[model samples]
Target: MNTAPPHQQAALLRRYQHRIHRVPRNLVVQPTGFCNLDCTYCYLPDRDDKTPMPTAVAEAVARSASELVGGHHRKPLGLIWHAGEPLALGRRRFTELLQPFEELRRKGLLEHAVQTNATLIDDEWCDLLTEYGFRVGVSIDGPKDLTLRRTDRRGRPAFDRIMRGVERLQHRGVPFSLIAVVSRENITHPDRLLDFLAALRPVSIGLNIEESEGVNTERHPPTREQAIEFWLKVLAWSRRQPGGTAPVRELERLGRYLRMSRTQRADRAHLSRVDPLPTIARNGDVFLLSPELAGITAPTYNDFRAGNVLEQPISAILREAHRLSYVGEFLTGLEECESTCEFFDYCRGSQAGNRYFEHQTFAVAETDYCRVTEQAPVLALADTVRKERTT
Candidate 1:
């Protein structure tokens, strides 16, 4: 049990039935716990475990996902092959794992993508990805020196190998996005990072600040001023795209808020704008909302594993899991954001895992995460739009 105050537990359970959501928008399949690199800040607790997901789990999830996406065309249900070094699965084995997902894609029922460190992307891997129309995402942190923490087991720098992988993708003309984890080191020089990425000419960029999760607990979150400046500068650099630059997805999303229609803004019923993203761990343990939420256990919460796909369908499990006490804790946090946060309409309370890690409760609002990711960019862009209107 959580052993928190009884009042706290009671608060979380109030009218919990009202919060049951539909099938998730994204389904993340964590096929293995093995990763070749040793990023010092990695939050995944299972990086050392080499257990690969059983083929049965993937089959079950694929079958369930096929049905969900097939029936509800507008749920935005998709699959993400992530949670560890996805490419490490190797081409042949990965293809088998991707069998169900490819079927979903072929039938036009779902979209699929792989978030890889891009270390093991051979020509064969690229061919498979491109053939299936997978929008691949490469994890990199710009220059070699800046990525000292993301090294291999032999303590070698990962920059060269990752860049080689990046180069391979470019050479093959494979469309991909760069997913960069912004930390204290890279946040200082957004320009150098931007320049390096622009040279590669990625399809897009995703910036994720170092979060206080799992073992990455000791976070050195950037200051409000620093975050504001970095995002704005990055946004400005991205504006030079007509000349040449990859679009930053974070800035693009923030920019969308500036131009949202009343209908778009007011449709708060689908809050978070999507149901919890589901993460099926290697062992068929299902977790919803955040893939990062997998492999962690605290008092009373359990793994938040709704059910195993081998035994039951995901939709059925999630529908029932929605009524669990832990879900109520998170939904209360959502209510907190709605009642208190200025950015509640924009962020829908941020990630549940982030809240529990930072605030020790899932029902709180506004962390350094919300400040840097949701508030800063929107404020920066919204301020710019306001200034343009005045001028």
Candidate 2:
């Protein structure tokens, strides 16, 4: 479908030739979709089933994962335990699911992490997480009022539970991070949000702009100008905080740019690591791009089984990802981007789901995400750095 001229295609091929054989370092595993709290803006829609992966299935996935990474010169795999709440599988099953990966770690094959809503965390959970050195990322918006919509099917506010979970993690001295979903209701009070998170003092912070494809489609998505304004305010607040390691998302982009320019590390870009950043669901289905695409059924199938790890090799899975027309477009965009934009070295381009939702194709130009992620923040950071140097 992409009909670029021969010369342009040749140049693009040369630029990306260095990246042809790169293997992924991170893999997201969904134990189940059995989350306790039901956030309004959740991208995963079918969270009611609450089915846990059988121990055998989890073992097979771990074995396949080990084989995949082992074939790639034993590159360390960062296994990210993600879900409707990975903790919903409970501690015992959770431990069981992670055992094979722990064995791989013992063999020096992989690393493990768990991303949770923190509503189910306890001292025991904290102890297990700390014992395994599992990096935990808590999902919280801002404050009780802002997170009022984060409730259960019974319409009970989960703020108290989540806070209790955070307290346990803090008390146990477990290293963890925070992930906040920014929406129209919360974007106006950026300073308040930052201040609230600052009190918790997370290792890092990730702020995601609300997308319209999931549970919150009825809610108004924030405009690009509004999101930019919110991020700018947050950046100003972050600069004033002393001894804080909480890397704001937008500021991290600037930091990533600086690091890439100085170090020339090809892996510094966000989503450019490699193909098939594996996202394995509870039923053994492996999603290629991201976990957000879990519930989206293509025109043919009714369920979210993109492919199964038990039946296919990881290399074949990655090949399928490469064959996608949108994947090619996304790669083309990245290859050409650096010529016109200095920040191209840092951007991994927009997430595939974002492109799919906004433009109906993963490979298309990221006009929406670019408005806030690329265009506004990079230019502002460049200007500020230039002004400071000149001054």
Candidate 3:
């Protein structure tokens, strides 16, 4: 646990002032609310709805992008198509959805990516992916035994299907990345996970600790010991790589944070002004800070919607985002995190969705999500590097 001493904690809190610098650097658009697989741990509430984003809603999103992505942004906005298996929308319908953003892409205002189960990747899908120059991300949990939880509607394992899709991408020569969920079943087998990832050969890898969020109330969050051991194995594996560990997202983040000077670490500008990371639903409703919160219905929080783009530009919603009840409550949580957590400089705060799902409110700090994802990894990596320097 990164619990700062009292004097330093007070100074840190004074610096950040508990303000969320809301910036729209990325847009996560749900092309549809249907997934082909019934992964046991999926948090999406409407995975079976099969409702694709209306073309008009997509057009509305694009129209609003100018306001969100224009002006002083030095890089193109990241437009990620995710949630409920984006590929389930089908190629033609998916193409139609992408059409609205053609101008944005051409104008260099946006870059495209897709987070998919990879069970739908065929030559045609690969063609579409290549045509758009997408940064493809496959959601695979490792070999068959580890992925038994990821299944189709009839309860058939999707491991083989997912691999076939991966094979298709490799055969088509498309570069890609992988995002794997780390849970109880797989947390103790870091070597197995790393070996599988090495064989698959994604350009990069991101490990998302299994979370208790939205509809997935039953979660087996890894123990602190399990998480630390897992990350240490990953860090060691990464160290042995001749090139570097940059491919492992978690280790890379740890390295960068550890390398920062104390002054740089203390600089709260980047930490406090985290990208709001708006996730737009098929209906044009926007969920800020956390994409996982999209499409969830919590009557107490107005379904966690900042606003619907169909009604107004996302910029307008963002401009008034601080006034939204949940957003305000979340800011209060940040104050708590800054005042207490020694890892606040590195983590900023837990995701809004995690806070809400775990505690049922945004005005709280810390959760199993942060412990396994943030604290454990940081401690593991930092201890490993320090030991290495001394040795």
| Candidate 3 lDDT over residue span 139-227, tens digit each | 99988999998999999999999999999999999989998998999988877887797678788899888988878887667788889
RMSD of each: 3.4, 4.1, 5.4
**How many clashing residue pairs are found in candidate 1?**
1
What stretches of model 1 exceed 4 Å from their correct place?
A: 1-21, 262-272, 382-391
Q: Report every candidate's CA lDDT.
A: 0.78, 0.71, 0.83
TM-score of 3: 0.92
Candidate 1: C-alpha RMSD after superposition: 3.4
lDDT of 1: 0.78
Per-model TM values vs. the true structure: 0.90, 0.86, 0.92
Candidate 2 ranges beyond 4 A from true positions: 1-21, 71-75, 262-275, 300-306, 332-343, 383-391
Best by lDDT: 3
lDDT of 2 by residue, 1-391 (tens): 2246778656555543344334667778888877777777777776886888887767877777777676566557888888788888889998898787777877667878888888888888888887777888898888998888789779898888889999988888888889888888898988888788868878888877777664445777788788667766776787888875577866876776676678777555433544457788777777766577776766432233446877775556665454444446556665555556554555655455666666555545555666666666666566556767999
Error of 1 at 304 (Å): 1.5
Record all residue pairs in model 3 with backbone atoms less than 3 Å apart, i.e. clashing. 2-342
Q: Could you give the candidate ranking by TM-score, starting with the highest?
A: 3, 1, 2
Instruction: Give candidate 3 misplaced runs (Cα > 4 Å).
Output: 1-18, 244-246, 262-268, 385-391
Please, what are the lDDT tens digits per residue for candidate 1 over residues 1-391? 2344767655543434344356567788898878999888888888988788877888999888976776574734678889879778777778888886776777677777888888888788888888877879999988887778888988888888888888889999998999888888889888888788777889888888778887787757677777888887787677765754678888777656555744476645444454667789999988876777789876567767777898889878765664555676788787787899888777767787888778777777778788988888877777667877999
1 or 2, greater by TM-score: 1
Ranked by lDDT from best down, the candidates are 3, 1, 2
For TM-score, the strongest prediction is 3
